[model samples]
Target chain A: MREAIILPTLSDTMETGRLVQWLKQVGDSVKKGDVLAEVETDKAVMDVEAFHDGYLAGPLSQADSDIPVGTVIGYISDSPEQAHEDQGSIPEKTTVAKGMPVGKTTTKELNQRDTSPVATAKQAVPDTDTSVPVSSQQSGIKASPYARGLARELGIELHQVSTASDGIIHAPQVLSAALAGPVPNLDAGPAYRYKLFTTMHKAVANNMIATLSTPTFRVSARLSFTPLKDLAHEQQQSVTLLLARACALCVQKHPHFNAVYTPRAMAMREQVDVGIAVDIPGGLVTPVLRDAARRPLDELNDDWRILRDKVKRNRLGPDDYQGATFYLSNLGVFEQVTHFDAIVPPGAAAILSLGAEQDGKVEFTLSCDHRVVFGADAARFLATLSQLLDNPKDSLCDAAKDQ
Target chain B: MVEQVYYWQALNRALDIELAADESVIVLGEDVGLFGGSYRVTDGLYAKYGEWRLRDTPISEGSFTGLAVGAAMVGLRPVVELMTINFALLALDPIINMAAKVPFMSGGQFPMPLVVRMPGGVAKQLAAQHSQRLEQTLMNVPGLRIAVPATPQDAYWQLRQAIRSDEPIIILEHELLYFSKGPLEVGLEAPPMHRAQVRREGTDLSIVTYSGMLDVSLRAAEQLTEKGIEAEVIDLRSLRPIDWDTCSASLEKTHRLLVVEEDSRFAGAGAEIAAGLTERCFFNLDAAPQRVAALELPIPFNASLEAASIPRIADIIAAAEKLCSP
Candidate 1:
């Protein structure tokens, strides 16, 4: 009878333990209580004692993989030859030991069955496998298409081009590999393309593109903020804060503007999670201020401060970036942007973009989703905002008196 | 209303009530069950709950702590008390990794409501081991709720809240404050978990501290008051899910800031508070935030040296004065 080593508790508290060093290797005879490996726990390193006496058969997980606990790290059997044969050189065999309990699968099972000897052989013996499949398209490594093109252009062997992401060749890898050669060609290739956005920017770009593609309408209005500026000067507060207060109040009244769009079922959400687009060095980022309609001006200011700092540091996590029913991107700081069309972020039904205050009046743009909002709703929203901003002194008083 | 009680008594009462209310609540530690705990906080607990709930384990903090982790996973709420935080080193695994990261790593599938209580900070001449204060260590550990109750009301409410929360919570009680008396109105209701409680209100400077240093902060506030310098004292009872709202509000009011902690000044919990405040309340600040903390050295056994090792009220007052100075 052969016994398989399955991870005892898949979701154990100590899921990933660092393998200090594997004491036993393939073909090594192990007895009960024999030292198999050392695992570093949170506190200290402890010896992992083997519970069964068997020959070690391993395509064992390497160190630093943060392997999920209860996943079979290796296999052990009574006979060395049988275990070796049963494992079929570690890469080709995919026969999961049967008769194990439900939810119990050995290391053999985790390996996907690849009847193609060439695939398994490639993993098992890199040199021999690469020599046989020089002309084959599949490199088994993941690299970008540009990288593969550059490699081919440079006459670099596909197997020698080690950098592949999920079998796709990435451009950077190919560029680096090309650089390693003597008198390497540095000029751009026909297949090469420049990246338009960084990782974070790409996410923002995708969402913005999706938003622009959606049915949307624009409404512009100029409100006299001469009173608001005077009020801010008297109250010793910023005009930006005054605008934020008015926006919050408007959100409370025209709750429909504070909504999310659902494309799957063609519905708009009711909850108001307001997103404030803070202009950082890398363009803009909108950190959502949850429940903005309910929170006071002071509270909103507090949230704004946190979000602004987060944007500056580029340390905004998913909680800060995700979820915004509506967006408020103010470009009033720039003297040139008196009025400009604003792009609505995905999930938000509308975005209120405030422009620079000029000639005793502040230009404002209200961008809304035509699928959910209308001209009448935009009019009400603008009216409320204008009222609040015009009497900025009242907004200051309300904030100061907030409990 | 269950009668109002002091923080120490309230904490003890909460333990009693919770243990009585649920069979899953079990207390385990050295000198906890039979000896009634070092501070006698567990006094009469063993007699009432019997050996099951108030079971005592060997001095093996590591293995027994691992046992508690297993017990918690198997539908039991174990309150593992370390006689002093110095001994927590022996159980750092179960506390830091298993108990804290389990819920988060499991993707909310399993939330271990385990509470680890320990007396941290310097009191007498207990030397380096016994007098070590690592509030910052717990603060640095993610996925765990760190509670440092400054007052009696917090003492009781935090423990109760920790029990109710679906996460790991560390209750760091200052050794010097086990018997300190303070007005505590308990039994009516409890405040929100992780919310910072304002101990005193002022407009000039904000004194932020937690656990044992809270006493010194309050005393410093009183001293500053006599000098005509109003200082607001905020007790950050919950370290993890920090009450940023309360701290931000106070900072907005009092531009000058000072943080006091029993931990060392170098990379202490005060650093995080100061850095966070600096980011959120940058424009509102007048003077850079100052931290009054223990000198960067191992706590000594000498009474005078130990006293000097931990932050004193005088240090806090001086820091506040310096911050307020034009």
Candidate 2:
């Protein structure tokens, strides 16, 4: 049986991938797990491997043509003979140029894919050429060679343009209407505009937009401690990590402060995964520590450093950044900052804003969802947090102390 | 001890002094010959220091400018004359690509001890083709030092200091000032090349300029003083590696700046100075920095039109008056 192979959602962030270079051509036999073609995603060039064994078929979108994701990049069959028969369906002129197809594909286009069996089958199955002409003209539009060539060059649809008075498509009209100018000649170089955005930027945008939905209330106060500076030197860990440990221990005592609130369910959670807001080059990222209330101080130090480095390199996958119960945004590095309020991230109930260190004292602001956690509960959490910070070693276990 | 000379002649004296003081120095360019260069900056040097040391070449500005880089790479200090900076358009490949970049790119294995001199800025009715002020254009490239000296004393001292440094330096001179006479002081003295000089001290406001406009700015400051304005004049002798410390220090005292230039107002070197001042002394500023510059229209060929094309002393005085107003 001929099995249709459609594009699968690769990473949680990927929208579409370009068919860079097809390793297997029409009529070539493929097997399960065989690398069929290379696809270029925004982040990196990746290999698209086959899920089922089959003979490759044609009328396959030409190698360089950009099609929507799940639009039958290629097909697989139960037998090599069937794959050979499928080759007749693809356009003869469709072949990869250089190494890959050159075009941009964003993630928003990939989200529109319909995963139903019927839609996938219709996309993957190749249609017979005997039913209709393979050229762009069979759709009932007569365009001259020059007009057709100009349309392809500009990436314009010939169907959208009217026929010229001389019964031939005018290049100037096509260019003026489609490109907003006289059509650039085929010999002219392709016009390109560059846009630069890293994976870290996309992640930051998503988190900020998600965070705005929560009705966050900011509560600020100054927490004085002379021992923190000396303890930080003794442990060789940043004051930020020590503060995180203090918050984690405090969350364990007052679970309401650490819990997440769901508006739909009208419920609060019990687990604590503290989101430590690390400032990356492009923007900020909050990588969470699972069960931070249970982890030792030294473990938190090691984990925070590793996560911050991952954020800078844009190597943090979705799992590394997700599942936060609360966040800690420390601005103690910038001396001018007295206090600042931050938005609470979605799926998290609260965020704690840490201000600049002044006169050997640390100022903090705890902003939370008032619907789930009360003002008194927040005060109790801060008191417990202060106590843990006073002697962090007493709060952390022996094994964690070694990290 | 008290002789006087043209600003360009003083520049040649400084070059000769540096070449004699250092064995690594050599001169390269078109018509910098026994005929002595188009502006005669290197007049008699060809006979004293033979063909190899004082080399004259074909009109290929790009290739010969590249040759200066190649020569500098092998421990030779080359001073390349672009004849007129209008011709520098041909030599940007070497000036920006090789001469400026070779040091950082090669990880400090070699130092580019090269000085490129070009008689720049609009000169009277030399027409649009011959007259152009692009010191600002050269200032945009990183790893290059730009020096635009106004006085003969600066012409001598800055030229001497530029030859001693390990970096590539582009010394821009106004073409009309080659014949202008000034007092000559030929010692190993004066301020560092990157520092701006306060030509005249006053309390009311500051008028900033460099190169040809420095004279105009000083004249403007003098005219404003009679009207009881007391405008302080600052000559921004160095553009790149800008003397921000001096400008900011002045702004702290004066609270206003009227930058005058022969270049067009849009994206001029004055903009960079204004931006730097804003960054360093934003709160100290009483009024926005005012710029007196050439009109956006092309440099016209007629004498009256050419005069209108550049910022005059009247323009500088008017701008300073506006800045000083309450």
For residue A9, model 2's alpha carbon misses the true position, in angstroms, by 74
The chain B TM-scores of all candidates, as shown, are 0.96, 0.97
Backbone clash pairs for candidate 2 read A15-A107, A20-A100, A54-A77, A55-A83, A58-A90, A59-A89, A59-A90
Native contact recovery (fnat) for each candidate is: 0.00, 0.00
TM-score of 1: 0.45
Off by over 4 Å in 2: A1-403
Off by over 4 Å in 1: A1-403, B1-7
- Report every candidate's CA lDDT: 0.73, 0.74
Angstrom error of the Cα, residue A185, model 1: value is: 61
C-alpha RMSD in Å of predicted model 2 compared with the true structure: 25.4
Q: What is the DockQ of each candidate?
A: 0.00, 0.00
Clashes of each: 14, 7
Candidate 2 local lDDT, residue B149: 88
